[model samples]
Structures are given as C-alpha cells and as structure tokens.
Target: MATGTVEHVKFRNRDMYWDIAADLHFPPGFDESKTYPAIVVAHPIGSCKEQTSGNVYAPALAEAGNVVIAFDASFQGASGGEPRFLEDPAQRVQDFSRVVDYLVTLPYVDADRIGVLGICGGGGYTLAAAKTEKRFKVVASVTGANFGRLQREMAGQNGGVIQALSTIGQQRTAEARGEQSAVNGFLPETAEAAKQTGDIDIIEAFEYYRTDRGQAEHGCVLFEAAHGTAVLGWDAFYLAEELLDQPLLIVIGDKDKQGAFGAYRDGHEIYERAASADKTLLEIDGASHYDLYDRPNGAGEALKTIVPFFNDKL
Candidate 1:
C-alpha cells in the first residue's frame, strides 16, 4: 500500500476551453503550513492519469517527500472538451502550463521549486512546454517521444505525408458536412492481436493499456482521425536547441529496439539539442520503452535517479 494521500481535483485549461481532471498526491507527513517542492507527471499518449502517471510515478514521488500531481490532458479522460478524443500537440503542451497555474495557487506548494516529468509522448510535450514555460524550474523525460515525428514517420512508411494530409483534409470536410468524425485506435484491440504483428512496442502497449496491468476505464487509446494533420506537423523539440535552457534529465531504455514508436533515438537527440547548461541522459539497461511506464526494471529503476535529481534540482 502507498503511504501518501490522493486528492481528486479539476482545473480549467484556459487556452483549450476545458476542465482538466487531475490527482494530487501529498507526502506521508504532509503539513499544510509547509511549502513543498512539486512535480507534474504527464501521462503518455492514449493514457490517463490513473495509469502510470497517477498510479506509479505520483505515489512514488510523493513518498519521496515531494508533492506530485498527475493529470489527464484536455479532451480525454474525465477532462471536458468537445470533439472528444482530439490529440492536438499544441493543446497538450499547453496542458502542462495550465497544470502549473493550478499548482502555484496551492499554499503548500513551493512555486519556485516546481518541476515536471513526462513519460512516452507526454515526455515530448514536457520538453516543448518547458521550452517556453519558464515557471517549470526543472524538466525530465522517461522514454520521451515526439508524437509528430512518430505520425510523420509512420505516414511515410504507410503511404506518404501528402497522402496522409489529403486523408485528414477529406475527413475534416466530411465532418463539416455533418458526418461523424472517424476515430482511430492507437494499437490493436487485444494483446494477442498486437503480438501477431511482431512489434514489441505494440505488444507491450496493448498489454499495458488493455490488461489489468495498467488498464483504467478512461484509458481508451482512441483519437480523432481529422486531427492527424496537426500531430504530423508539430515537433515537440522544435525550438529546444535555442530555448530549452532549464536543467534537464532524460531517461531511456538502452535495449529499446528503436522500433517505429521507440524513444531511444529521440532521447539522445534531445540530449544533444537542448541548450540546458545542466543535463544528464541515463539509459536503463535491459529495459524497453514501455518498461519505464510501470515495470520494476523500468519505472522503478528510473525513480532511483529521478527522485534524487528532482530533490537536488528543485
């Protein structure tokens, strides 16, 4: 059992026009009168707070003597937004800042000591957010991936950028003409289906999101088809070389196969591109991209480094 207490909370995303759902984790001996360093744990693409962010990292960070908040991005989970299942990178990046806005309002939160940790796709968005959001004093990513790059590369192999854009254009027109927008699943419906494809990332993703391992009612891996264009064009580290100057830590699996969805390459790329004066890259041997989500050899190993890094930096 966990030692910390969790508080269900909601806050407004001013730019996205939605109410964001989140969970706040307080340390075991939390004192209302004392300010504490805080961390914002961002969930992966197609995942909700109840999975890794809330279930794994939040409690662990709280137990390490920090206040941690795990949140569902707008348009997903319990968050409010129209055109449900939209996966806009711009909106996702903004979500972090919105979370910061809420965090600073808490009397027990030390606004100057706030940091952020993003996993998988959320890791990419965290980099983007920290680039411009100066309030985030420190930044870290676990198996971070640029979703836009993922979409573009996948589109390249499937058809082509032009073809993918044309499809999204047509979908948007159809929706404008009163047709229901098409929704697409992130992975195969079942772990068995994913295994049949012979892709380790997909198989692991299906196992995590579809099974009791990390499943949650709101962890639906679906997105609006028309929004593909937005994701395809966006780059999480667009201005990172020029603007991401905060202290940074990047953790990735050394054994990641650099598959279609692998973050191994991205992790190193960001480590090279980020202009942060203080930065460190850690690769966990014998772990894969999804392993960092919850597996002991993955997320657990990462915490050994993460808890100390945040404690020192924040």
Candidate 2:
C-alpha cells in the first residue's frame, strides 16, 4: 500500500510534446509550511513511472521525510511526445532536469538539498543529467543499465557483435519508409518465447515484465528499429567521472548475469570512474540485475542501504 498522498501531474520539456505526465509522492503527514529535502526518481529505459522504480521507490523515499517525484519519459508511458516508445538517451537525461525545475517551485521543498535516484536505464540517464545539471547535489543509482553497450557493439566497436550494423541498416531502411511493423517489438511477446531465446537477460526480463510478478501495461514498451542507430553513437560512460562532480552512490547485485547484452553492466565501473571524492559502491550478495528491480529480497534490501545514503549525503 502507498504510505503517502500521490498527486497526478503534468509538466513540460522542450521536445515536440511539451507535456510530461508524472506522479508526485508527497511525504507521509506532510507539512506544507515546513521545508524538506527532495529527490527526483527516474524509471528504467523502456519503462513507465509505475514500474518497479517509479512504483516502489517514491513511497519508500517519501516515507523517509523527503518529497519524491517519478515521471514517465517523453514519448513513453504517460508522457506526451511523438514516436511513442522512442529510446533517446539525450532527451531522457534532460527529463530529470525539467523535473528538478518543477521540484524547486514547491513551497515546502528545499531546493538546495535536492538529490537524484534512478533505477536501471534511468540510473544511466540520471548520471548523464548530473554531469551537466548541477541542481542535483547528490546522486545514487541502482542496477545502472548500460543500454549503449549494445549500441557500441552494433557499431562494430565490440567486434564480437559481428554484422550488427548490416542488420540494423536493413531494419533502418524499413523504418525510414514508415514500415512500423517491421521494427516495432522491443521484447519477447511471452515468457516461454523469452526463455527460448537462450538469453538470460531476456529470461529475467520475462520474469518481471511478462508475469504477474512485476508486470505493468506501460512496461511493455515497443520502439522503432531506427532506435538502434541513435544508440550506436551514444556512450553512457563517456567522460562520466570527469563530467560528474556530484557525490555518487551506485548499488548492484554481485550475481548480476553477464550476457552479451543486458543489465549486467557493473556499478563498480561507474563508482570507480566517478570524479566525486565521496563515492560509494554497494553490492548485494546473490542478487542479479533483475533482482535489483524486485524479488522481495531485492527491492527491500536495496532500500535499507539507499535510505541512509540519501539521509547522510543529501
């Protein structure tokens, strides 16, 4: 059950669709006159605010006496934008900044003490936002998704991801001529099919997005095949440590699956690369990349560490 009041909201970003829909999680027993710290929580890539991060993180953080807000990425979930399910990292990172702009307006929020927290791809985007948007004084990421790894591989940089460029090129042409059907499905349609892919990451994604365990209607995000083209040039880790000056905290499971592509990217790499003098990396024993999303032991265990990180640092 939710521990606080939730207000459905609409805000704006500079994109073609300016209205961004979001859920603001007010603190339990919130006092309008009293100032409180604030945190902007972001959902993973291809996910809406109601998924694990946006659904669970806000309430837990709000109950800890801070105001938290989770919003859908533009063009995905409830946010307004064209090219639905478009996965543009650059614009997604800016969403956090716009959220910060709104948070600073609340009478009860301490703008100077604001922090940021993101899960999976949101974590990666949150880091990108922090690099340039200094409004976020502290930063924390759980199960950071390095989706761009696939982007790099497809560009032939990884070498192991052979001929991905050609495959993507074919799909891109189909997409350019408005062949939406040829490049729409982003995930396996069913758990059984996901399991048949012989990919552990897809199997785990199926465990959450395709089942009663953690499924949400908006979590099933589809995208254009041309999406991979943009990703191929972007690097989530580029100049990360030098560009990010904020105190950073990254947490992930020790047992996160290492597939050719997936959430298996290391949190320690970001922690090590971060320029912050005050950075920490937390590893949960026996937890996987998907486990950090939730599994009773996952989300619950993560908050035990996350809450304190915010309290002490923010």
Pick by TM-score: which candidate is best?
1
lDDT of 1 by residue, 1-314 (tens): 24678999988745656799999999988888999999999998988999888988889989999999999999888898878888999889888889999999999999999999999999999999999999999999999999999888878864698899999999999999999889998898766789898877888888888888888988898998987888988999898989999999999998785556869999999999999999999999999988899999999999999999999998
Provide the overall lDDT of each model, using Cα atoms, as 2-decimal numbers.
Answer: 0.90, 0.79
Pick the lDDT winner. 1
Q: Residue 266 lDDT in model 1?
A: 95
Taking the tens digit of each residue's C-alpha lDDT, what string does model 2 give over 205-310? 7787777877788886576555555666677778986888898888887777575444445576777788999888888888877778876577788899899889
TM-scores vs. true structure, each candidate: 0.97, 0.90
Off by over 4 Å in 2: 13-16, 154-183, 260-264
